[model samples]
Target: MDKINLSVTIAVITMFISLFLSFFLVTVKTEHKLSNRLFAFFLILNAIDISVNLGYFFDIPLNARVFISSIFFLQLPAFYLYVLSVCYADFKLKPKHLIHVSTFLIANLILLPRFYTVSLASKISFLKKSSSMLEIQFNHVLVHIQIILYLIAAFMILRKAKKIYLENYAGASMESLNWLFQFTVALSTFYFIALLKNIFKFTEYPDISESLKIGLFLFELIIIFWYLYKALNNPGLFRNIDSRLKLVADIVSEDKNSAQLIDSEKEYNEDLLKLKSYMMEKRPFLNPSLTIQDVSKDLKIPVRDLSVLINHKLEQHFYDFVNTYRIENAMDILRDVTKSKVTVLEILYEVGFNSKSSFNTAFKKHTGNTPTSYRKSL
Candidate 1:
């Protein structure tokens, strides 16, 4: 086999092994409905990617090349969909999404005839020789379009998912978001390399092709392993450890006398105080959905202790505490004569309220007046 074929063979093997392990881990550990479906979809995409590499390795027939190219064109959108599903459980696939998928499919169908007419060897030779400015520009345009679409989808879901996690599962949510952000960065790097490869092709700098391929392969392997490690080692990777500890303390407090639980409670309280102080400094409460769990993770405090401190010492529920800060910040914004001209909705969002309704309700509860009235009074 040629050097390129040999490298492709090794890359294909690595991807196949990673794919197999990923599937096994997902099947064994995934419990959430959306996560399971996303994993399944991820597996399918990986399968297609592997098949494309395999077909190329063997110098498959021109018809096989056409099939593989179609699959390749579909892979990016599938990957973005998988990312969305993993990050957002409530994300529903819509008709508009289907339309987007169909567009890529139809475009591939239109090009398939041309793809099949070219011999496999001749196609490879053409790819190596072609430096046509028009073709390069066309490919670059397609690459940018894919990148834009993927980014829009990934970022939209990430923003919503981050809020949901913070509000609903605060203590563990920070860790989850941290990991998610890292994953996104890694994926983005891979896409960037792909973009660069297309640019190099357009610019007739074919020497970078091998380097791009290697980088792409390495990045994919890293992503697959990172995901598999999280899946297998901590299926509940997103759960807050501090919160679980606090729950234990709470249950024990209920069964024991105040005196008996005093020392333990005191220790827990001290830790919780440290955590709260850290969060106060960070001011994550600026996020309307920020919760006790997120604060705990940010401060590295046990979730249970954070819960206990908020519930017992502060005498406020988690959501109430978060909204209190959000409202307080909103008040400051409302009172600023220079910036007070900003709309109520703008102030609401500026202070971390996700919706105008929540901001209005929280402001009314905190200050006994609507934001507009408060602004006018100011």
Candidate 2:
């Protein structure tokens, strides 16, 4: 097939696959209903929205054109909700959100009567017209404005959320928002393509060729597949992290009465003392993959309090702080070679170091000797 027809084939196949996956996720996946539903809704709307391009390429019948405008209205809202559901489970669609959603409903309802009356040939002729009516051009501008607003709102939320996560958590392996960050970039690029296609319609300029729309849809296909790959492999990645972050958000945000006044420094010092006592007594650092949140929970202290105490006051990330304790334990075990009969690797694992390299590095830094050497010297 030629370049034009190739774009059509790719666009149709990609959109079809996207629509199919959305259906499959909603019906088959029980893990994250809210996230999946929102995602599926978003994709389905895109599938419908791109039908205009498909109509241009193939003579596919679009008997009812006006109702399809509703898909445009729903696209942004659906995507915005998908971000919220994926990023924050506690965030439900409140009545305030309903106000935004009503715009989609109203846009569709207002245009439905006029669109129903128009034939496919008229719609095609309107597209072919070098100078369409002002109303159509304005509507195109309004649609783009709506999309830009929604994209900005979603990106702001995701950016803030990612900032908060980085502040509270230290491990890269457990972080789930990395894909989300990339998703935002892809979505933003897709909007840029859409804007280019729609922007000049309001001007005296002749409408661009079907090639631009074809290229636009082709890029969209790539984005859809990328999204599908990430979503299918890690269906509940976002939901899982959302609930986790929510649990500790209060603790991580204000750090337990950040504004509470009553000898603030003295109170913090006292909490720090209590925290140190708990750490010494319980030795919770012996557990692998221990987090500040875990220690906070064990001490019945706010996660914010523990985070502030460890990260700010003690001047160590939670990872290093835990490993510090682990190294100390390993040194003690190394010195007590008479009772333990433990190997260096055993000491490493027992003290919560995930690997020997990390354990030796920590041990040597603090003790000036490897676990084996330290034991030998003893």
Per-residue accuracy of model 1 over 1-378 as CA lDDT, tens digit each: 465775586677666866686567456644455555556565566666667656644757755654554555566576676666556545567777675466456645554444446667866665555455344345446656776777777777666565444334423344555677677788778788877876675566776876686667777777877877876665665432121222333444773754544447667667767756765687797665565656777777665556656655566656566777778888888888889568887887777765555567768999999988988886
Clashing pairs in model 1, backbone N/Cα/C closer than 3 A: 170-293, 170-294, 171-293, 171-294, 242-302, 242-303, 242-304, 243-303, 243-304, 246-304
lDDT of 2 by residue, 278-371 (tens): 7689988777656667777777887756666666666665666666778887777777748466778877777776555667766888878877
lDDT of all the models against the reference?
Answer: 0.63, 0.68
The candidate maximizing lDDT is 2
Least accurate 10 contiguous residues by lDDT in model 2: 166-175
Give every collision pair in model 2.
251-304
* lDDT of the structure predicted as candidate 1: 0.63
Best-fitting candidate, measured by TM-score? 2
Give the lowest summed-lDDT range of ten residues in model 1: 239-248
lDDT of model number 2: 0.68
Per-residue lDDT for 257 in model 2? 67
Q: After superposition, how far is residue 267 of candidate 1 from its true place, in Å?
A: 35
